[model samples]
Target: MSRFFVNVYSIWAAFWFVFTFLLIFPFQFIFLQKEAWKPMAHRCNRVWAHLFFPLVGMPIRVRYEAGKPDPNQAYVFAANHFSYLDVASMMLIVDTYFAFLGKDVLKKAPLFGYMFSKLHIQVDRNDPKSRSKSLQRSYRALESGRSMVIYPEGGIRTSNPPQMHPSFKDGAFRMAIREQVPLIPISLLNNYQLLPDKKNMRLYPGSVKAVIHKPIETKGMTEADVENLRQQVFDIIQKTLDEYTANPKAHQNEFKRLTVI
Candidate 1:
């Protein structure tokens, strides 16, 4: 709770994070070498997260408002961005193979950067050319029947906790419509509280909770529907966050415990 303890715990968590990644780096490197083996490299990421989170005392739990998703189907997943921990927490959310559409800055992170650049799609949000190229890559991935995880807020630009950034970008919605895939909305209920986007980057150990809403069907939808669909997903996640902020305990027992160990 104190600043000193928060710093210490964060440092400890960071240590385990880097250590676990090092253990799996060789396998990931090999898996990333061939296009056919990229999915295996993503799974290695999940393994690393499972090892790091528990060691740092963060257990992940999920509750589905709708039924669980079918692993065989491809989907576009959109969730609010609030903390660095959200990246790792995603490995716990979707069980099947998927790639993340994250900021290009992640491509610069030490060992993880190389793996991410090869295994996932990265975009420079500020550059029109880069965004267009990333969207093309995402389209190709969807066409190949692979799912994608995108933070519709673009990045963690929110200064407020529990409250999401007012605008949700249309990229996720457009991709879902164009690909004729289901768009899944997720609410990361408590990540910002556990580990916020701040300069100091302090972290606390606790149960990370997420709510996966029912998939919004995009079949037969046109480009004209992108705005409505984006707003619809935003409202779903924002409403869930409001409810959790009002009564966090009401949703705790509602979630089925997901075993990470």
Candidate 2:
């Protein structure tokens, strides 16, 4: 499909998905039992992903270093974010129970806003207090055995395509070490390829690819080791991305459809 058609379909599908979710899920969400929302919300999100990806004509594909992560264990999934699709497509790969530490503006999105407030942890970067609160909430979530999805680069701030921003925020790594959870380096390799972070709501005809790198165990680590841990994940993902840039064809899939529970 052409770029024009892809953009048109994406805009149409996004609004439509939000409208449908508003009608069906908002009532349940408003009264969602706080402690019981994980499984309920995760099921709803998977349904949304199944509907949107096919509706927008974008196929999903995944490349896991190991087959997949154990659903029973909690993890801190750190990925590079370069496209709006990064968050949405995460549902296709992460089948385990997890919530994301996302930007505060995510709550302003139509139907997702309500769900984000109830199900995910949101942080306001400008406010030190808010960031502190979100970090506390994230630590509690990890302690309670719920995994988290965090972007190490913070957001899609890189000036150059496919290259990570020069540095990363310390929040994700800090919590991982303090909580002693395995941090999984996730590389959303195809998000920028399928949709560049440009001014327009643009898309392209392509398959999605995410590399779930081997988990880095943070046992017996402290705040002093945060940057070293951050750099370790950054190097692994950036190296895989650089290899993809050198040879994209090897990663292409003709009929492989990624499955997530």
Candidate 3:
């Protein structure tokens, strides 16, 4: 696609994103009014994502290598962070209700930020106190049977596409170990190409592909195993990402055989 069309499509996507959020804001606010209604607020978020993506010409396709997750179980979902699209794309991947451990900067994004602050756990990674508080909240969420979506790369620090940042944080692994929940590794195959992390924020119309690997059971694991567990999840996601990146045709073909949600 030409630069002109990319810019036009990006703008079109952005407009629908904001417009849909605004359209859903009233329902979100009402659903968020009580503690019990928060899950309904998350459902509102999923509805918003379902509306915005197709309206912007992007369809989400996910393949579960080990089969879909059990609805009754809670998991710690860790995925590579490459683009802004990862956040919304998550809503499409996991059907069960969960909270996101996102950067505190999301709390500054106009009207959306306010809702995010109330619904998700935001952390200032630079602040020790804030990080501690966020982790505590994450622990409580898991204790209450809700899952969490955490980017182990710690916020898109990678300069190269498909290649992850060198280090993975121990928070996600540690929390899963402590909570005795299964940890699921997810690979977002092509979000960076669809919407590159750039100043211009250009978006292309294409299918958003993701692979949900089998969950790694953490029951009976101790804190000493954090490093090994983190490395395991990282390797699983990185290998899938490298495979798909090397064979774009294979990636495209795989999605065609699977249903697009």
Report the lDDT tens digits of candidate 1 across residue range 1-261: 788888899899989988999999999999999999988898898888788878887888899877788889999999999998898889978877898998989889898899999999999999999999999999999999899999999898788878899998899999999999999999999999898887777888788899999999999999999999999999999999999899999866779766553
Instruction: Count steric clashes of candidate 1.
Output: 0
Global lDDT of each candidate: 0.90, 0.82, 0.91
**Candidate 3: global Cα-lDDT?**
0.91
Clashing pairs in 2: none
TM of each candidate vs. truth? 0.97, 0.90, 0.96
Mind giving the per-residue lDDT tens digits that candidate 2 earns over 103-140?
A: 99989976678777778899999999999999999999
Top of the candidates by TM-score = 1
User: Over 4 Å off in model 3, which ranges?
Assistant: 251-261
lDDT of 2 at 258: 69
Q: Cα deviation in Å at residue 46, candidate 3?
A: 0.6
Which prediction has more favorable TM-score, 1 or 3? Answer: 1
At residue 3, candidate 2 shows an lDDT of 61
